[model samples]
Target: MFTFEIFREEVITCYKEKKQQHKLYSQLENPSPGNLRNLCLIIFSNGLSKEDTQTFNEFFNPLNQSNELETSINRFDLDKLRPLRNFILGKAKNPKDEVVKLLAILVDFQPRPYENWKKSNSTTVIENDNVESGEKDSSEIEAEIPVNTEQAITALNDANSLKSNSKSKYLVVTLGLVLLLGVFLFIKYGTLQKQCMYWNNDRYIAVDCKEKIPGSEVIALDEHKLNNFRRITRPDTLSNKDVSRVWYSKVNNSVEFFTEPGHHPLYDKPLKAVTAYILNQHALEIKN
Candidate 1:
């Protein structure tokens, strides 16, 4: 009994109640299966408990790569989603009650009736009405019925079979073309790897090597030298000049040092003034 419109309304209501960002909400205003899937992923990632999140990742990750439910609503396989519904309900407390309702709608989703079926039924009703109204001789009508019925049924069956075969062929050809296009794009663009770092005046800028800055002298990319850059803790014994010579930036638990004051080549964080700490306790000295 569930319809796509019902699912859409439920999701839109949930989004509003949660006060999710306007940009994402705008995307849901005219939802496609692709965008709806993306929104569901965001919801799952943000709403689920740690244990539930892990289970969701394990169950849904493989399906994400497949073309299982990315197409038209009629082709959607609700059986694939039933196990997820069961798992969500099995939990002691349902933290994601909204997700449970959405899954239920998907599992119960009914495809709309085909137009041909409606036309066939309408035609049958008209024929029956004419017979009942005594518009023709009863015997004559009965004699004509068997031949007309047989021919109509045979023609309908043939038309349906041809339609089914044509659709199958179209799907196969479309898939092949898509596959070919994907491979072509990968081969062309994927090979040109973006340079991650470029050396600037006395320091390296953590930017794409291809980035253009007018009048800036950029040296050749040296990944080995960049990788070797490490933070050296300033010793209190050192002069102010020595401390100024090295720039530092804290990266997680560790601090990274550069030869000159600039942003980190990897982290992109602005370098800070060096602090007085004994080199022996903090880091090993790296010779320039």
Candidate 2:
């Protein structure tokens, strides 16, 4: 966890100091831990645009909006982020605006247990280091368990469990919690492929979901089809493929795709027809 309160303060300080917007941008261009990059982008996208909104719009396109959304949600208080939220909301005249999805994902985020531990122990040496020397720091090993992997695995597989082990009395509850949380989050959110849907021209279309926002709509594609799309487009290994963007409308309570490229013929229709087409075509892939 970052010193979110301090970061919020710094952001406010920068704005209040009347630093040139580009100067602020330059300073924020290289923030520590990388997660702060999104906050900076949001600030620039919202604040700096006042001078030349059209140019700003032209320079920072929809694809960049999705890229900012891909960044991880950090531990900032909703109260502190209110200014940014309000700024974004005020600009997003359309409820289906792509920025709305960015805000939604940030608000809906749930930090993991391991993330909590890391934040809590950020300054501690044990938390930052690996047990490479086959030795566990007493502070890190809070529970009386075999610290070695071989011993731990044997203890876990044994019918009697660690009870039969003369070396330790109990399992590492903290370790178990970390592993469980890691696995759960991985299964729940990590396996999603590089697929996303975007709203465009009164309808939706399939696109590269850089942000990988969950529950976004997508054109039904076979594993084979996706591989082919990836091969043909060959998105920058660093970035997502340049494709149309998507949004989630809180009003409609459904994923909205941009009807830009008409990635699928059925997605190019007007609202009603597009909705019906998606319901009919991607029915199997649609989430309940």
Error of 2 at 141 (Å): 20
On residues 104-205, what C-alpha lDDT tens digit does candidate 1 reach at each position?
322222221212224555677887787456433433433443357778577666556655665686799899999999999987567445444454443445
Regions more than 4 Å wrong, model 2:
1-106, 109-171, 185-267, 270-288
* True-vs-predicted CA distance for residue 231, candidate 2, Å: 33
TM-score of 2: 0.21
Question: Candidate 1 — what's its lDDT?
Answer: 0.46
Estimate, for each residue in 1-288, the C-alpha lDDT of model 2 and write its tens digit: 464443333333444343332223222333332323344344442343232333223233433443342231222223433434443334323332223323322222222122332455465655346433223333233354488998776655552432344134224656688899999999756856534554333433446555443455555433322321111111111111211121111123443433121233233333221233343333324432
Worst 10 residues of 1 by lDDT: 105-114
Give per-residue lDDT, candidate 1, residue 142: 37
| TM-scores, each model vs. reference | 0.21, 0.21
